[model samples]
Target: MGNYQSGDNTIQGERLSRREAVFDKMDDDSFALFYAGRRKYSSGESLFPFAVNKDFYYLTGIEQEGSSLLLSKRGGECREFLFIDPYEESKRRFYGKKLSIDEAKRLTGIPNVLLSTYLTSRLDRLLRQGLDGEEPVKKGYFDYSPELKIGPELDVKTFVNSLKVVYPDLHDLDARPLVMPLRKCKSDSEVEEIKKAAGYAKEGLLSAYSVLRPGAYLYDLGLFYEHAANSASSCSGLCHLTHIASGEEACYRDPFPGQKQAKEGEIVLLDVGAKSGQYGASICRSVPVSGRYTPHQALIYKIVLNCLRAMENLARPLISLKRINEFALDYLACECLREGLLPSKEAIYSIAYPNMVCELGLDCPEDYGELTLEEGDVIALYPGLYLSGEATAIKLKDVYLVTERGCRRLSDADIEIEDIERRFALQSK
Candidate 1:
């Protein structure tokens, strides 16, 4: 969500931010970046209690800006030091409500608290003492995503370099690799939250379908989807922009498009998802605004549906995601030729191969990985069908999980094209 806050906006009582939730679980000696800055609110400027990075929150469950977590196993004592903004009304007026140093410590359940103002001084002392005029320490860690992006604009690189000047023993450790290895797997709670989002996505899809008509604009449909997500909680809108493509624009890869209105009998593909408490689920369903798919539309729809079913049937615990993706491409390719949409199987496979530029605008091998669908795994499968230059297209997307006996669709939406037609016909009547 943009850092904007409006009158209608409410904090919803600070639940543990995802970063904090993650952080509270990390091993001692693991450190993470915490956000410390003013942010734009719809009403005006405000300070985030702190939006800790997801990985960090996954371990700590501490959320407050101007806070740094130093975890160490020294002297037989596990240290959880939290540095926070000192309580000041002037600061509050400028940045909004902030957890005072003590409040920050209490909220985090971490005992030791230090005034944020002393970070530079404390770091200086550590550097001087550790260096002792000997060979410099070689390794240190920090999140560099924001730094890299903002470096040119804010001389962030220079600031980092200056830190090295203070402590010549500096080694940069990238956090992405370390954290991604774990974040890829969801904890029980995390998985449940995702499923909740998936359920909401399905409900939202149905909500959109009911509103489908011949002349509605794409963004209007986007509103219906967002409304469904917000109905759950103060979700962070969407992790990405909504895509609602119609008519000629349906051939475009992603559903995001210019403000085109749906026309008579045009199939509209709505690709949307919601982020509930930061976890996200994406689901897409294509429908005929006129309440019935033409034969061509049905052909495309069935192709995508069969491919999706193939992926679902094969998904199992410990299957490589890369392999599954390959399987999806092969299934789509064979179906394309079998349906007489493409002339030959060899032609379909040739164009579908990696490194081969699909002459027909078909980019096969949609995504990578052979991630075996383990129990509790959540995966998004998007099977799309489009004739290179044709305006007609159909794509179905859903999040599924592999179970012990079979797979279950987490995105509980009405997926059948026939069902959609029936429902739309009833609604129109």
Candidate 2:
């Protein structure tokens, strides 16, 4: 089947044929881990239900919590194994229905299935037997451990440590980088999924643009965005937070996840994404709160837009990600100085260090020099300029992608300041 589609639609079943084939081709003794847990939202339960880890779902297609996967490939023979929680009366009453053992086996195409509770015991026996070269199980790799939490928010290092106990004699592999390297380059189908996400994101922007005004609060904008994403498709905003920031707060990067009201003569920034068919897009756009661009805002917007445009022109196969950022950063420095946003080299240097260039996930390489951009590389380029004034301020951001030739702007919306102001005139007045 074709890897990508021109229209916005979910890719399920046979549509994911190629990805399934590739996952099955992974080396034996190797596995990937994914954990979906409840998130605490102040208003109520999170809008999105528990999210399945993208990589884990990519391989086994098992969407459930407390589940693990093992993929074995030896002598050209492939076997997919799934470990999941067995049926429990309390669990059924609490979290709704779970996949029965037989159903999971059929759905995952895995002839072998085991209850999650028996994983440690069964895996231990299997490892010993395989280590002895008796039961056709030889040196295996445990892709994850259920211990030692690390990094931001939901760390799962402990789960990784648990792997050591399960396959004591098997070789340990760094599955994170390995899996990330494979995921770095998007296939045609993956790109199409991202495009579908972008479509819903655009719809969210349209909804926000239609009602946004100077007096609108950031939290209000968030509601508008989520509503549009939800209305577009039942599953459009499956995973991810819809971020809406205004004026100086928009320039502050994370923005502390609070409410910021829109004001005239300020920039309203929306750095948001939507998920369709489990694939996602990271798109951002900025408009003037007053709906019309001010001379000062327009000047800075042009420079930031130019930086993003430059990235689009330079992104291609075989180029390093670090090198790409360097080029973009250098252009930004020059533009910022030329526009008088940053007074000197020192000022420009400080802002670009960790704030300007952000790597979205762990998949990106730490060193830009070692990372090369491949064809069909879906890169998110955020070019922003924040000018914080004592009373009135503005910040503008725009995200784009790199195609075979130049790049495409996924966040399609008008950038004029007045359009934003007038669109919300009824609410503001």
Candidate 3:
């Protein structure tokens, strides 16, 4: 979106500070290695768009592939080195210009920049050199996750494994535990990017709402949102598949936008968003297929909307996701009971609706454990209601920023019944 500047000095300074923090946690004579993921193969001769590793991108803003960051602490001094793909005329002709060492230094604030080919040599030298007659490097930290097993070629696992073979005495550590806590809170710049993404998402949803009507295919409604987002100067496109379901299809768990056609008096459920600067926004809304909601549809929509509102009001610094989830169930239970959707509090879990509030940031629907809210945490509250006997399902999803004074909504679209009816009526006229 717009002219993408790699990052500014302030951003670079922040990244450097983050690296320093990681080094501070390391024991003496310890080091850590992180890598920018490799390009993935989609099919013969074609490749998937390069997605940078979140942990690597968090410490260094460089997004290019085959790059590596090495952070080492010795005695009282910490050293940082960044190794990236070296400039090659052939690559420049085929893939455009690769990032130069000077540019990488400017972007990441790491002065020690070298070619990727030299990474092993550098590590070998470090391992061989010992100060005060002790091992030069005692512990090595890396980001390890089960997902890494799926794509060994794109991760640092192979490289670390090879190191273990040569230096059997070296201790290996998982850096995810060290970096995950740092990632939980968002910086001001990161929050701004997320907010921009949310704003673009709101525009996309509004466009989808205006054109939704009886007989429109669910896929077409999804395209309306994608088109609106793709045309924006700030939006890259829909971050994930737009979820659009109508009638009985709405009750389908994890529905994807399909060819199902809308009908009069049917409720359509949608979950969609756009990406801004690699950050994603998640927003979901429900509306009647016709210009106006039926009485029953309106009742379910209002209940879920109220649940979302209550949860948003309660979000703030120090509020754990466990607390938010408990509040949502309690509020939903009371409302469902009042509406006769549930027979009693004991039957709360029997309702077949998705009622989870998760953190949304660099990744959409991040791991639930990572969604716990603290000051500076950005989260999504998505609550749904499904009446299996009636074959009806409705949901509302929104993102919020946990601030000192509570929380502020990042994804805001008018889901109020009056607003939807008025907008749809205008479109019909």
Candidate 4:
């Protein structure tokens, strides 16, 4: 995440440029709808906080819930409209102030701002009768996730996705193609924001050392990291969950790190991130609970650290993450073989499925092998080594920027053996 696209007056211009770029790609008689999704509830009376759609926020720079953006190149006219939840005095007093129409206009530079209630009717009207004596919209674009199951309710679908039911003849298109290229290659500002996020996340991880002694609960460590992350992020909180695991849990994937007690010998693995504006960074660190790595742990750590270094040394602009993956796998395999962990380089693939560095999984489409990365593309390098024989897992996560020179590290969260030993050495004295 480069500097967050906020506060600066120029950000509105950037949002406008993004919307214009989308429009430039669309055919005439085409329209696009981007939604700011509604929040979901976990249980009775409690609900998850609303997060704006990345595509929507990219174009509008608005984070309010239930907001929508409509762009059209219909007939002979090009139009842009922003729809927002109507201002209610009671809701404002209760839940605090949400975005008003004027504020949205000012923020997004979209002149045609309307209430959310008008969206359905307005779109229907546009499709039924052409405005300015022109043809109706024949094609529409929507950001539909591949994970969305084809179900009966169609209840939670975005407003544009529901258009299929109403007008089966409309040519619906995936919005990702038009937006992802722009997103995958971040702007200078976005790079700054991500750098800030990585620094903040590192701060959170370092702060956890305050409570990082033997016998501390993995759950409590997670809590400490979250609190520190939020504080470091200036109260915006986590962009995604923190992964804190120790001992057996560290040896495998456990989505939730629970009450596993730290021992003097085990390693604690933390995959932590924190937000700076809409950007966040992922960084992993594995450290010994005793504050000094044993010979075995150090061996594993160095192996994983070298795997990450491969990415930093090999990644460059115009190369795909797929290519980098191959280089890193080779490095990992050769290292394992040299250490007698494996017999041959080819044998590494057998275990590579669960223990590989795939940064595309974090930000880009699944089929990112062919997509050429440009300068400023940020990616995470998280290499995990699970040694069931030793009952331990070694991992290191870092975020890097693809540059002409190589992959420039945005987050290098080091868990050096010397640093750990020195910290505890002072305590022992």
Q: Rank the models by TM-score, top first.
A: 3, 4, 1, 2
Error of 1 at 383 (Å): 1.4
Question: How high is the CA lDDT of each candidate model?
Answer: 0.59, 0.58, 0.78, 0.73
Which structure among the candidates has the greatest lDDT? 3
TM-score per candidate: 0.77, 0.77, 0.91, 0.90
User: In angstroms, how far off is 218's CA in candidate 1?
Assistant: 1.9
Q: Write one digit per residue (lDDT tens) for candidate 4, span 171-275.
A: 888877887666776777777878888888888887776677888887888887888788888876666678888776666664466877788888888877777
**Model 4 TM-score (2 dp):** 0.90
- Model 2 bad stretches (over 4 Å): 1-49, 73-76, 87-93, 101-106, 131-140, 144-170, 235-239, 256-259, 350-369, 390-406, 409-411, 415-429
Q: Rank the candidates by lDDT, best first.
A: 3, 4, 1, 2
User: What is candidate 3's lDDT per residue for 1-429, written digit by digit as tens?
Assistant: 012233444776678778877887877788888877777777787877777777788889877878888887777678888899888887788877899987987787787889998988878766767423456676889877544321435455766777889987778998876676787788898898888888888888888876787888888888888888777734475567788897777777778878778888888888887788777888888888777878888888888888888888888877778887888888888999988888997687776443478887766766636344688888888888877677678888887888988988886587789988898888888
